[model samples]
Target: MAATKVLVVDDSLTMRALISGALERIPNVEVVGLADGAEEARALVERLRPDVMTLDVEMPGISGLQYLAELMEVRPMPVIMFSTRTAAGAQDTVEALRLGAIECFPKPKVAVPAELEKIIAKLGRCIKAAKGATLRKAASPASHAILPQIEWNGRVLAIGGDAASTKTIFDLLGSFPANCPPTIVVQHLNEDVAAAMVGKLDMKVAARVVMAEDGMAIEQGSIYYAPPGEAHLVVDGSVPPRLRLLSRDPVAGARPSISVLFASLARSVGADTVGLRLNEGDDGTSGLDAMATSDGYCIKPNPAGGFELSKKTMTQAIIEPELARMVLKLCSR
Candidate 1:
């Protein structure tokens, strides 16, 4: 297999060196070139034609966001943004993701050797994943005149997605009306990014979207996003259900493991649960499989169903809850 070639783009020499050294340590990953700014990065892209790019969120000259918009317009490739763990940085990182960046990694505050190693390993994994990601020009949000209203039937919708499924998640949520079913999300993202994502989704979707908190009540027309780090989100087997945040060891190398969430849903909601797996691979396959065992509904993002958002018409297409309900009906059959 050919090594995944990567270009490091950062204004700081030290940061560039850090990213380059980290990428070089990963197996089958080659640091093809380093660029200080957007122009240099663009030049290097034309010259080296690396398979992936690690870009800084903020850069001199043409800003990283500006460069990203232009890059996606001309040469669409997988990009991972290196961001700072701050409010402003999180905002920019989310924008970058919207602009078609595959992943975003927040720089460690202390930059200790151990922390750096962890970041490096994660970055390498993201870079490798990026190679398989579908890159396209960013799409504008679709216009929906009428959001469908569905009856709340004591069922829960559990959605799990990977880095490549960010847009899909947004579109899925947009499909729901103000009185949509109860929903839980287990998207792989940093804590800061997750918080920012919840805020962003809350505004875009008619339902209330928030970060999962310990003992938070599960309500219809609300979406709870599992927080990143060491805690796993679980549903308490109580009446009018509540969410529990558990501090357990990571499962399948994911703290908020999709499998864990699915298993919990299977035990709690059982046949009433609808599990949607978007752009997730083996790490979440077992969980979705387990959900099937419990006779819950499981759905994969089918290209024909408008999960792919690259098409302008698809972006503007109305998302029907009836489509999901029909899938559940088929599962029962």
Candidate 2:
């Protein structure tokens, strides 16, 4: 296998050596440059142009973030930040991730040769994923797929996502008419952040958004979602739908998961269910496939960013959840 090239950037000679030795364990990773600071690192990146960079957040002369901003503007490669996990350090790490570093890992105070090797191995995997981590754009305004012949009869549409998922979900759900289908959302996030996010999602129709609570009978005018690290919000087949709470393992990597909510919606509503998945992380094929296979119409965000498709059924327009609603409304008639 051709070597997966890497650039190790740190101020300490000991750190450089430790990082270098670690890279050797990964079968075909070649250490092209051992840079001392941002200046040297920049030159090395321009010349050697390694596949990935292990950057120290704290470096002399130019700060790591400044260097990162500059590097991204010039040559954007998968950059990983090796930082300590202190409160201050963690803050920097999170900021780096937001600024576009693929992933962030803690750095040992004194690089232990033993642990360093394992770090390098795992880092290689992360770098490969970052390279493939293609951030898709948001979908365009959806068409009026909900036929005018039959309106909101009786169906539930649920949506969910983390920080990156907001824009996409809003665009897809925006297509619903003024009297849109009764919808529920369980966005995996903190309460404050979720509220702040909702402020941005101004639905075109008369859809009211709120933090979901137990026994709150789903109404026609509003939409419900899980409120951060609270209880899991679910829909009971009451009138429109009743919201309930439960304590359980965060399914599909979320407490109030899109999967769990949609799974239940798939159960309660059956053919009257619609769901949308907008995950930024590609954890595994299961969640991706689940979004495709659930009994009800399952709509998956397309790679185009503007289009969505149904894997189980042909014709992207009639994907899961929405398609389920279409059938349910037909039945209600």
Candidate 3:
């Protein structure tokens, strides 16, 4: 196989040389260019076109976070952030991940090059994993956690979520009524665990659920789901439009980005749209707030609910089916 081309971006010449040396030792991995900072990275990205980039969290003009966001918007590439092991650095690294970096590397002030070499090995694996991973998609309207009553009235209800947001959808759709709204979800799930999640959810809810298709119609009792791996999904203007797929990269570390759906729903259903999210990270916080503030009746998971995942607690203290019925009743009123 041809050598995997690499780019090392850092303001520190020592740091760049160390990273380059580590990569050089690795078989089939080639360091193509050394960028002084984000500006250089941008220019070199156009010229060298490296397979992967090792980005520093802090730089001269534009920070790594800012650079990554700009890079993703224009010519997208896989970026692994090399960050300091400080608390502030951790926060920025998380922000980088949310902004679409593959992963982060914590650069500690260590004694030997061997210590840094270990970090390089880990970085390489992360790059390889990201290149093969799938992205999240927009959840179907039917997958709304706080789904509407299965009235099958006139329009369809769609829902979508990513890794940090799908659990909120599950909470919002608990004990859903089969007769309620026709729903769909484009949840971002891993391959090994993806198949199991639909059933774990289906057994608790009333709707007969199935994976989604591009041409499926909006029905009264059934909801469909699309397994979004790495492409973004959107709905076109149709008599209940079909799910359209795109080769675009991720948004806020999400494939079926909530922003994409919320924007689409605002265009499609207008005031009829309702949205919700449980803030797991900054990505969730921003997305939920934007959607709610926009003329849609949006709900957020109450942090007061103490619904922490690691704590083995659920924040959805109330059943969503009842909430859905309540929402429907209010809409009729």
The model with the greatest lDDT is: 1
lDDT of each: 0.77, 0.62, 0.60
TM-score of each: 0.82, 0.58, 0.46
Candidate 2 C-alpha lDDT tens digits along 1-333: 467788988888988888877776676678889999998998888899688888988887887777876676567777777777576675565445444566666788666886665466657776555543444322332432433433555656666555435444554445444455566776554444455445444443335766677888876656666777846676777665688888887665666666567666656667666565555453212433544465555555565543364535664544433643443343243
Candidate 3, 42: how far from true, in Å? 53
RMSD (Å) of each candidate, 1 decimal: 5.5, 7.7, 16.8
- Writing each residue's lDDT as its tens digit, candidate 3 over 70-119 gives 87767667777787766666556545655566667777587458778656
Better of 2 and 3 by TM-score: 2
Q: Write the per-residue lDDT of candidate 1 for residues 229-310, one digit (tens) a residue.
A: 8898888788877899889998888889888888888888777787777765665678777777777767665544533211
Off by over 4 Å in 2: 117-121, 131-265, 268-284, 287-308, 311-333
Candidate 1 Cα misplacement greater than 4 A, ranges: 108-115, 141-146, 301-333
Most TM-score-accurate candidate: 1
Better of 1 and 3 by lDDT: 1
Ranking, lDDT, top scorer first:
1, 2, 3
